[model samples]
Target: MTPLISPRARPLAAALLCGALAFGALATSAQAAFNPPIRMSHGIEYMSGGIGSDEAKLMETVLPRWPASFEFAIKDHQGADFAADVHVTVRDGRGVALLDNVVAGGPFMVARLEPGSYQVEATLRGQTLKQPLQVVFGTPTKATFLWPAGTDMAAAGTRAVQ
Candidate 1:
């Protein structure tokens, strides 16, 4: 013989279970709707210099600023037998850094940023290169940068280059 739940308690238990299930579903849906506001991508290439020698390396960074998050991609296009490291920095019009790091093996980087204008810069080794970017609130913006081959210690910086 097994004990059974009382008629009065059975309805209460059912109601509570139903409420819990509904709450869980709502929470899951809310999480799925979240998004970022910034996106970025990068690429690299090596160019020949004088005397058939590797001169400068070309590094490219692509940025796509979304309404909720920032996304980006990076690539390296260098000649044979040469590779370069790439770093990226993003700042607001007031020279505030939003994102900065070295990208090695990734298709893109995304971040959440406030609505406004921004500047993006990319660097290779230590030298400073030019890769300006702009971001707008409630909209999307894209930017790209190019670096020459044989660029050792290439460093890049961006600050409200409006």
Candidate 2:
């Protein structure tokens, strides 16, 4: 049997294969690291995540376009730390519940909501915090919910709130 590939082409073929495999791996990892899963509930679209540096950067860039955005944290003398496993609820001005018990997967959340008044309730570790929001067209409404200093947020580590 005769060799199909010339000896001179073997090295170039191997290099090209290796480069293609490396590029595939890099693209896959970059996409996973940067894209947080967007979810839908009760006709509303939302996303929650800001755990790592890359995801946080992605969230910051995308958040402004959302009608509603929320941040969960623990603030105290030691400083502030991001929080997770937060349950959130949203209600319209009439007090009809739109979202109930929607747990956030990370420290930040963004939502696409109609322009109106809303009441948001975020619960963390048995404590619930409530904030009223006014979501308007062309303006983003932001809310931050903070727990007391003693809360254990070891999963998030410690970082200054940006």
Candidate 3:
């Protein structure tokens, strides 16, 4: 003798299967919608030697002005066989400092920043190099400082003289 399931039982099984599938689809969609995308903010690429004396001083004062949790990049020039210590300072349009004392070399120190206009400064070797850099919100920005070989305070002063 053969046995058969009742019509009611068949409907219940079908309903259960459909409910499970719906739940799975909803879970998948939710995960996809909530996932955050990767982003980048600041980068500094140096060529020639590195940050000159003037640039170094500027960076020291600028980096601390940025809000906490910002991305940054620093690339040293490969042509010159010299190492440089680079620093950055960030400020807002109101002349308020946001970030300071950010230092890096080689291909390290990448970070992200909040969306806002910022003034950036860079320094190398205790000398101010570049200042008043403008950083727009939600946009990737960069600052590069080139240091020639054997740059001395006197030489830098003379260049300023010219």
Residues 40-109 of candidate 3 have per-residue lDDT tens digits of 3244222111144444333333334432222222223434322334565666677665556555442112
Any idea what lDDT model 3 has? Answer: 0.44
Question: Which candidate achieves the best lDDT against the true structure?
Answer: 2
Positional deviation of residue 58's Cα in model 1 after best superposition, in angstroms: 24
Q: lDDT tens string, model 2, 1-162?
A: 877888999999999999999999998997777988889888899999887778888888888989999999988887788888889999999998787789888888999999999999999888899999999899999999999877655645335685
Stretches of candidate 3 off by over 4 Å are 1-83, 105-109, 151-162
Counting clashing residue pairs in each candidate, in order, gives: 50, 0, 36
Name the regions of candidate 2 deviating beyond 4 angstroms: 1-30, 153-158
lDDT of 2: 0.87
Measured with C-alpha atoms, the lDDT of residue 127 in candidate 3 is 58
- As a TM-score, model 1 comes out at 0.39
Between the candidate structures 2 and 3, which one is better when assessed by TM-score?
2
What C-alpha lDDT do the candidate models reach, one value each?
Answer: 0.41, 0.87, 0.44
Q: Order of all candidates by lDDT, from best down to worst?
A: 2, 3, 1
What's the CA RMSD for each of the models? 13.6, 5.0, 14.8
Per-residue C-alpha lDDT of model 1 across residues 110-161, encoded as one tens digit per residue: 3455666667665555655554555466565544344444553222321111
Q: Which one wins by lDDT: 2 or 3?
A: 2
Worst 10 residues of 1 by lDDT: 49-58
Pairs with steric clashes in candidate 2: none
